[model samples]
Structures are given as C-alpha cells and as structure tokens.
Target: MAATKVLVVDDSLTMRALISGALERIPNVEVVGLADGAEEARALVERLRPDVMTLDVEMPGISGLQYLAELMEVRPMPVIMFSTRTAAGAQDTVEALRLGAIECFPKPKVAVPAELEKIIAKLGRCIKAAKGATLRKAASPASHAILPQIEWNGRVLAIGGDAASTKTIFDLLGSFPANCPPTIVVQHLNEDVAAAMVGKLDMKVAARVVMAEDGMAIEQGSIYYAPPGEAHLVVDGSVPPRLRLLSRDPVAGARPSISVLFASLARSVGADTVGLRLNEGDDGTSGLDAMATSDGYCIKPNPAGGFELSKKTMTQAIIEPELARMVLKLCSR
Candidate 1:
C-alpha cells in the first residue's frame, strides 16, 4: 500500500513544524511538504500532489476558510482544519466542514507533551480516514431553497452519521420546511463541535434545531441534535415521546451512539420511527437492523447515488433539493 501523503499549511512556523512532526510519526503517513501561506501552499500542492492536507483556520493574508473555498472550486481534495477552541473558531470550523473539509481538530492551548501525544494520535486516525474521502464543491445556495409544505404523520425522523456526512446532513436538513416533522440527529462529534453544529444548523435551516436535553419533549416542527458527551440520547416511551439523556458506557465506541438512538426509537415508537443512516460503519447498523425488525422505515445513501429505502432503491442524489420531496412523500400524513 502506498503511504498517505500530506501537506501541512500554517502561517506560524512552530505550528507548521508541530503538525509535520506529528504526521511523520504516523506509521503509513508521509508529510510531503510544508507551507507558510496560501501562495506557498498552492505551489506545494501542485508539486507534491498530497493525498490530504492539514490547514490552519486563521492565516495571514488569505484566510484558511477563503483558501479552502478556492481550493474546492479549482482542485478538490481532502482537507482537515486546525482551529482554536473559541466561540468564533468553532463556528468557523463548522463552516469549513460544510465547505468540504473532512475534519477539524482544535489546536492545543498549552502544548503539553501528554496532550500533544493524544492530539497526534487522533490526527493520525483522521488522516487515515480521509485518505479516499470524496471531496465536492459546496452546493449552490439555490439547492437550499424551501420545499413545499407537508403535514407530519406523527412519525419521528432519526438521522445518524459520522464526520464525513456533515455536508449531507446540512443539505438534507436545509431543505426541510420550518414545520417539518420531529427530527433527531446523532452525528459523531465531540461536545464543542456538536454545540457549534447545532448553532449553525439552527441559523441556516428552516426547521428549528436545538441540542437535545434530558427530558425534553420531542415535538413536531422541531429538530433535535443529540449532544455528544457523557450520555446517550434516547426516547422515552411516552405519549408524545420525550428525549432522555442516558449516562452509560460508550456503545460501539461512540457515546450518543446512533445504534442506541435507533434502537430506542424502535422500542418506543415502533413503526412510527424513520431512520436515515448516512455513513457506513458497524456503529449504527445494529440499531438500523432493530428499526427494520419493528417495521420502521430505514433509508441510507446508495454509493451509486440516490437512496436505499429498506430493500428498495431510489435513484436520485440524497443531497439534492429533491430529497426533501422524497422524505415528504414518505412521512407525510
């Protein structure tokens, strides 16, 4: 297997060295080149043809977000962003992800040896996961134009995905009407990132988006995101189901596990549940299977395009505006 080549881009000399050094320590990764700014990074990218890139969010002259937008337009490739864990930085990081960056890592505050090691390990894993990830230009604003209204059928919509599915989630949710059915999302993210994502979605999407809180009622016309941290978000088997934050060990290596969420919905809501699996992995399959057993509708993206509903396939891009039309057909009263 060929090594995954990486380019490190940051204006700070120390950060450039630190990122390059960490990437070099990974077993199957090679730091092909390092650049201090957008111009140098562009030249290096043309020369090195790196498989992935580590980009700093804030750089002098052309900012990282600006550079990322340009790069996605001209030559799309996998990019991971590094940013400080500030309120503004978190929002910017979410924007970068929405713009096609594969992942975002928070820059270490103290740079202690122990914390650095952990960050390096996680960064290596992210780079490996990003090796063959598909990068596409951001969808045009027209793609998010509002969809026709539909009355909810008292069905709960549950969506689950990992980091790679952020854009799909944004696209799908953005097209939803302000009065769409009750929706719950479980995207694999850390606490800070999850909070930022919820904020971003609430601002941009027509539907109201909020982080799921313990004992919050799951109501129609609102979207709830499972907050990532010490608890798994589950639905209590109540008359108008309410969200429950259950503190337990991580299931399938994820807290707020998608499997846990789907299984809970299957048990509580039965056929009234609809599940969308966005990223393929073992993490969410078990719960999806449980949903299937309860006669709940299950949908996932087909690699060829469109979506798979139960065993049947629909041939249309899941991220297109058409998706809202299809989902409405499935869940409308």
Candidate 2:
C-alpha cells in the first residue's frame, strides 16, 4: 500500500511537533507539512495536496471550525480535529464534526511519554480511517425559499449514520415538512457535537429539532437527536413513546449503539417505523436488520460523489432536494 500523506495544523509549536513526530513514527504514514493556523493550513493544503489533515479546533486567524466550513465547500478533503476537553472546546469540536470532519480527538493535557503513546495510537488510527473517507460538497435549499407542503404521515422515522453522513443528515432533515413524522436519529458523534448538529438541523428543517432527553414525549413535526459519547438513547415502547438515556457500557463499541435504538423501535412500533441507514457500516447494519425483522421498512441512500467502498456507499441522499422530495413521496404512501 502507498504511504498516507498528512498535514498537521495547530497554533501551538509544541503540539505540531508532538503530532508530527508521532505520525512519522507510524509505518506507511508520512507527515508532509505543518501549519500554525488556518491561513497557513489552507495554503499548505493547496500546495501539498496531502491525503488527510489534522486540525486544531481553535486557531489564531481563522478558527479551524471556520476553515473547515470553507474547505468542504471548495477543495474538500478528509479532516480530523484535535480539540481541547473544555466545554467551549467540546462545542467547537462538535461544530467541526457537523461541518464534515471525519473525527475528533481531545488534545492531550499532559505530554508524558505514556500519554503521548496513547495519543499517537489514536492519531494513527484516525489518520488511516480518514484517509479512506469520502467527501462531497454539501447541498441544501436556500433558507428563504418556500418549502412545499407534504401529506402528514403518522409513521415514525429513525436514522443511524456515522461521521461521513453529516451532510446526508442535514439534507434529509431539511426536506421534512412542518407536519413530518416524529423522527429519531442515532448518529455516532461526541455528545457535545451532537447538540450543535441538532441546532443546525433545526434551523434548516421545518421540523422542531432537539436533543433527546429521558421521558421526553415523542411528537409529530419534531425530531430528536440521540445523545452521543457514553450515553445511549432508547425509546420506551409505551403508549405515546418516551425517550430514555442509558449509561450502560458500549455495545459493538458504540455507546449510543444504533442497534440498541433500532431494536427498541422495532419492538415498539414494528411496521409503523421506517429505518434509514446512511453511510454506515456493519455496526449499524444489525440494527437495520432488527428493524427489518420486525416488519419495519428500510432504505439506504444511493451513493453519490465520494470514494466508493464495497462496505458503505456514499450519496447525497436527502441533501439533494429531489431525493428529499422522493423520500417524502415514498413515506407518505
């Protein structure tokens, strides 16, 4: 296999060096250039054309979050964020993920050798995984455009996706009408980032969007995003349907296991549920299977402008207004 080329971007000289040195030590991984901020990083990205980049969420001139938004629009490439663990940092990291970054890791607070080793392991893994990620320009309708009406369906919709599915998620949610079905989503992301995503989606979609809370009533024309990180969001199969947050250990390595939510919905609503699996792999497939077994309908978005993996196909899915239109047409039937 050819070596993976990486660009390291951060304001801290120490951080850049630590990340560069660690990445270079891994086999078949090469650190091509280093930039101290988004301005420098942008120039380097154009000049070097590195396979992947590690970005710091906070930067001097343009913040990493700002630059990522601009980058995904023009010269899209795989990006991973190195962020601080503070509350503000967590929020910015979440924004970055929503803006299409492939992964986010908390910056090491201490630079001990052991901690450095652990950071190195994480960076290496993220870099390789990101190298294989597919990116496409995001598509959505103008904020002021009039949205057409849709026949309200009482069927419930549940979606599960990974980091690569950010744009897909935005597109899907944006197409819903004010009377769209009660929707739930389990997207594998940091809890902090998940909240930001909910805010953004709410702004774009007619449906009211919010983070799922335990005991919150599921209502039509509203969407609930699953909490990420160590908590899994599940729905109690009771009349009127209530949300639950669990602190149990991760299943299949996902704390908010998609399978857990899918299984719960399968048992609860069965044929009344529609499961949409977008840009996810085997980890989410089992959940879709559970929904299918329970007589729920399942749909996978058609893959579009990204590198094709035999495992997961990439597509704009709901991002494109036409697909969004089609989704509503099918669901209303």
Candidate 3:
C-alpha cells in the first residue's frame, strides 16, 4: 500500500520540524509538505493534495479554525489539530473538532524526550485511523430543530462513539427535545477533552449535559457523560436505573469502555434500551451484539449516508432528524 501523505501546518518553525520529524519516523507515513500559515498551507494543499493534515489550532494571520472552516467548505479532507491543554485552548480544540477536524492532540509543553515519544506514538495511531475517515462539511446546528416532547415510557437512550463521532454526537443530541429520555453517552476522550465537550454540550444543546457521578440517578431529560479515567460507567439494574462508576481495568483499551456500558444497559433495560453506535470501532461490536441479542434496538452508520439498524431485517437508511424522530417513537411505544 502507498504511504499516507500528510501536510504539516504551524506558525512556529521549530514546531513544524518537530511534528514533521515525528511523523517521518512512523512507518507508512510520508510528510508531503510543511507550511507556516494558512496561505502557504492552502497553496501546498492545492499542489500536494495530501491525504491528511496536521494543523496548529492558533496561527498568525488566518487562524487554524478559520482555515479549517474554509477548507471544509471548498475541499473537505481529514485534519488533525494540535493545541495546548490550557482552558482556552481546550475550548478552541472542541470548536475545531465540531468543525470537522478528525482529532486533536495537545502540544508538548516541555519537549521532554520521553514525553515527546509517547505523544508521537499516539499521534501516529491517530494518523493511521484518520486515513480511513470520511470527511464532509459540518451542518449548521440551527438547521436541526429541536424535537417535540415525547411521552415518558421509562426507557433509556445509550450512545457510544470514538473521536470521529464528535460532530455526529453534537448534531444528534442537539435535535433532541429538552425533556428527552434519560440519555447516557460514552465517548473515548481524555479528561480535559471530555470536560470541554460536556461544557459545550450543556451550553449548546437543549438537554442538560453533565459528567456522570457515582450513584447518580438516571433522571429524565438529562444526558450523562462518562468521565474518562480509571473507572468505567455502568448502569445499575434497579427499580429506577442509576449510574455507577466502577473501578475496573480498561476494557478493549478504553477505561470508559462502550462495551461495559452497553452490556449493562442490555441487562438492566432489555428492550427498553436504545443503543446508538457512531463511528465506533470493533471494541463495541460485542456490546452492541449483546444489546441486540437481549432484544434492545441498535443503530449504526449505514456508510451510504445516515444510519441503519444493526439487524439485517431493517435496511433502510435514515438521516439524523429522522433518527431523532425514530428514537422518540421507539421509546414512546
């Protein structure tokens, strides 16, 4: 197979070299070109036509975020952002991801040799995964109207995803009504990114979004995000389901494993549970299978566009708004 071509864009010369050097060390990756700012980056993009790009979140003239927006409009392609882990940087990184960047990695602070190796290793894996990502312009949040309130049926909605599912999750939850079902989400993220995402979702979406806490009641109309760390979030099969933060080893390489959450929902809610898998990898397949075997409904991306159920019996693909409507109908019934 041909190497994955990459373009490195950053204002600092040292950073450009550092990133390019690290990428060159990885097998099956080629640094096609390096640019200092958006203008140079734009010209290089037209000339080099790289498969993926690594962009610094902040730049001198046209910011990385601004360039990303323009690029998505004209020629969409996979992009990964590099930013500091500061509070302000985290907010901007979240915005970048929402704008269609494949992933975001924090820039090295001290440039310590050991730490740089670790970060580069993770970035290499991200770059590899990004080559297969499907890129498209992000839809305006205003375009999706909030769904109408549905009758309460004691059902729960569970969502699981990875880095590629950021925008989808935002759009999906944004369309939900203010009093939608009690929803739980498990997205593979670091603590900083997870906190920023929760904050953004709480402010933008109609439903309340909060990080899950041990023994928290799974209430209606609220969305709980499983915090990333040593513990996995699971649902207790009680009279009224409650969230539990269980300290366990990472499952399928994710501490907040989607499989653990889905399996718990399958046991607790049975058919009352609705599971949506967005851009998730193989780790969640078993959990989704468990949900389906227990008679719970499962939805996954259809590849042609929109989403379809995991069951082969239903093959019709439905768009995001229709998905929200279907979830409402299913839970109400």
Top lDDT prediction, candidate number: 3
Tens digit per residue, CA lDDT, model 2, 138-198: 5533443334666656678887887667766666676677877788998887666677677
Off by over 4 Å in 1: 111-114, 140-143, 311-321
Give, for candidate 2, the lowest lDDT window spanning 10 residues: 306-315
lDDT tens readout by residue for model 1, 183-221 = 999999877888989988898888899999999999877
What shift in Å separates residue 199 of candidate 3 from its native position after superposition? 1.0
What RMSD, rounded to one decimal, does every model reach? 2.2, 4.1, 1.7
- TM for candidate 1 is 0.93
Every model's TM-score: 0.93, 0.83, 0.95
- Once fitted onto the true fold, the runs of candidate 3 whose alpha carbons sit more than 4 angstroms away are 111-114, 311-315
| Better by TM-score, candidate 2 or 1 | 1
Model 1 lDDT-worst window of ten: 311-320
Global Cα lDDT for candidate 2: 0.76
Off by over 4 Å in 2: 111-122, 139-146, 229-231, 246-248, 301-323
